[model samples]
Target: MIERVLAIRHDKIGDFVLYWPALFLLKSALPKASIEVFVAPAVQALAEACPYVDHVIVDTGDDKATSQKFIERNYDAVIVSCSEFRIYKMIRHLDSAYKLAPKHNWYQHLYKHTADAQYKQGEACWRGGCMLVEHFLTQHGIDIPELPQQYWDLSAERQKWRSYYGQEGNEKLIFIHAGTGGSSGSLSPSDFANLSTNISDKTQVDCKFVLTYSGAEEELAQQIFDQLSKKSIKVVMAKPLSSLADFAKSIVAADMFIAGSTGPLHLAGLHNIPTVGFYAGRRSAPIVRWQTLSHSDRRLSYTPPIGKRTGKNMSLIDFNAVEKDVVAYLDANYA
Candidate 1:
């Protein structure tokens, strides 16, 4: 039995969140195994919060030291998920009984010739229909169990949400996320203004618009809030969420989620919240990969080509296409 494991995935918030299912499966398969994770420092808190993880080692620029530390621990196996040259090199030097990672022909030279196992990440596509997380775990001989979707749960966050927007029985909450990091996933200020106006003009319900985004998008969030305020839309911006659980709770409380293809969209799916995804440049890859829950519907503005160069060559989709989908979703689900 695998008594100790090291799972390495050093990526963004959404990347880490998507691995929840795999983490669950690993824990179930080896209940007694001490699972340690090597992750970006920003996401170290998330790894520590996971009940399955026994320890978390942050990748703070000292690859040799990190590998040495793992060697000393005498881990049974190491699972590498990062697609970085530096990370692959470090994993190759680690002394583990078994090693598993996504197979890439280009990087074969970086791994030990006798590496115990190598799993291809794309195996999910051929498995008919399974969540990417499940696909990853199954490759490692782990079975996924039925678990309530994972979310970051923060005690004070709920209270803060309640206090900021007085919890009235009649209030209808609609969450809007307007910005993405350095991409067209950000709605033009005018598009956001138009959307907020349209919602108020068409709906008679006691509607409120909630703004959510990382601190990096503060300026854009403010712009959207100001536009909605002019339309007399009740707007609330909670402090940036402290954990994935807090973000999930905020999405769960909403009647519907309207956002670009970003972290909130995925979180909405996890919570089974109905969402209108306003994808910017092209079709989102994750939406196509995972089977949507019964409550979810995806409206892509631009259907990207079916190849590796797809998203790179696409131009911005017409805003009218986005407006139609959002309006249709709101009318059907909310009205």
Candidate 2:
């Protein structure tokens, strides 16, 4: 009987959110056990907010200190989701009977058992990584379910956010983020405004647009807002979110979210809000890899043509296609 477990994936936002399903599996497989997570300092609050995790340890920059925290946890199982060699070495003496990770470089030999899968064109990071976690459970005679049983009970937050936003029953709320064009390119400010205007023009339902952006991207966000304001349709700049938690709370009130394959898009996906993600058509950041990890039926992902991989051509992605699909989603859900 596993009484305690340790999961390590000290990484960035998109990287961190990818592990939610695996964490779900762990909590479900051993319902009575305590699940502890080691994540980066920046995401400590996000990890803490997850329903599955009982305790969160922020990664200490000091190696000895990090190892001490791991040893202190008395975990019966360990799951390594990060590829850092430092992480592997820190857990070298994990007293756990089970250790699982993906089969990778010679470093993978460190794990007692490894999941057999390669990160390739056909495989998504979340699915491939979850395979490692799944293999560990199956070996121990635990059944892997067809779908992940994980979602935050954000109903209370949603209600409060709804009241806070003063959302009436009629209008469809859409949140948009146009940043770094999925980190591989840039979608011009004019294009963002055009898409916003098109959504309003195409949708029969009354629409509201919230241009969400971080501190650094305020100017870009403002530029999009300025462009949209010039149109007859209404667009508003989102109030500064005090923290990631704040942004997450606000997402609960959204009808649809649109973004390049950026961090906030993943944040909204975690909430299972409908999302439309724009992705680059590069092998390293393929549509399959960076697609918003949401409920399959709730997301629409668009990638440029095979030859149009460069950032300069991101505008070539059809606004008509985006508007049509988004309006369709709005029609189905809200109309």
Candidate 3:
């Protein structure tokens, strides 16, 4: 009988967030099951806030930590969403009834049972995650079902975040993440400045842009704020967010979010926030791969023409086209 479960996905931001449906399935299959998430320390807060998760264990891939994670507790089942070889090796601790993981190599034999994630070259990431989760549940005699765009319950936090930011008025608030986090193309501050003004011109509703960035993005934010200053658009540099939780709160409080395919974009998707994401045209990193997993109608993904898949090649993403879509999306949804 499955009573306690461990779900592991010690990966990056978007990668970790993509496990929404799989996690949902785990809880659904075993509502009374004590579900714990094993994630990188980077996403501890986010995992903690997950309503389906009962506990959050920060898995740092060290030998000692792995032993402690495995030996310290008794799990009835184990699920691995991360493809790290070492992570698979640490499955020695799972003396459970079921161990569900994606079969990639000989190392996968470590798990008593496994599923094929069937990763295609340009597959939608969230779907692949769902497939693995579904494979596990079905193989274990559970049926798969539909899932929400995400599973975040931040009602209390939403109110608190709004009050903290102060409810100024009905002015639409669009959170813009201007800096690259080593994951996406670097849209220059000037490009964003232009986008802000273009959005203002395109949207019927009066909107304000809140520029949010990580610790390393301060200088980039400054440049964006300075550029926005050149225009009449009402723009504010968001107060420095201290953690991933704080960042999520800010997204909850915003009316819309704009960014490249980065962490906050996925965070915004988790809350079903309307988002316009800029993506590259590379086959490996196509729009379908990391498209924001928000409400289908609420998400807009824009990609450049297919060409060189290098960083410098990001400039090929037609900024003008993106601006047009942003305007149209807002007008269609909010207008």
Which candidate ranks first by TM-score, i.e. highest? 2
Candidate 1 structure quality by residue, lDDT tens digits, 97-195: 666655455774555432323333433121221233354456667767765443333444544565455546666677778775322245566676677
lDDT of each: 0.61, 0.77, 0.76
Index of the highest-lDDT prediction: 2
Give lDDT tens digits, candidate 3, residues 1-335: 77788888888877888787678877877798898888889999888877778988887658677757765778877777776667766766556767777878777876767787876775667777777778877877887877865567566577666656554666677888886653455677777788889889878877888888777787888988888787777888888778887677567887788886478888888888888877766656756677776877887776666666542465666777877887877777667
**Model 2 ranges off by over 4 Å:** 117-123, 146-150, 181-185, 283-285, 308-312
Q: Estimate each model's TM-score.
A: 0.74, 0.92, 0.91
Return the lDDT, model 3, position 50.
75
Clash pairs detected, candidate 1 = 151-245, 152-244, 152-245, 152-246, 153-245
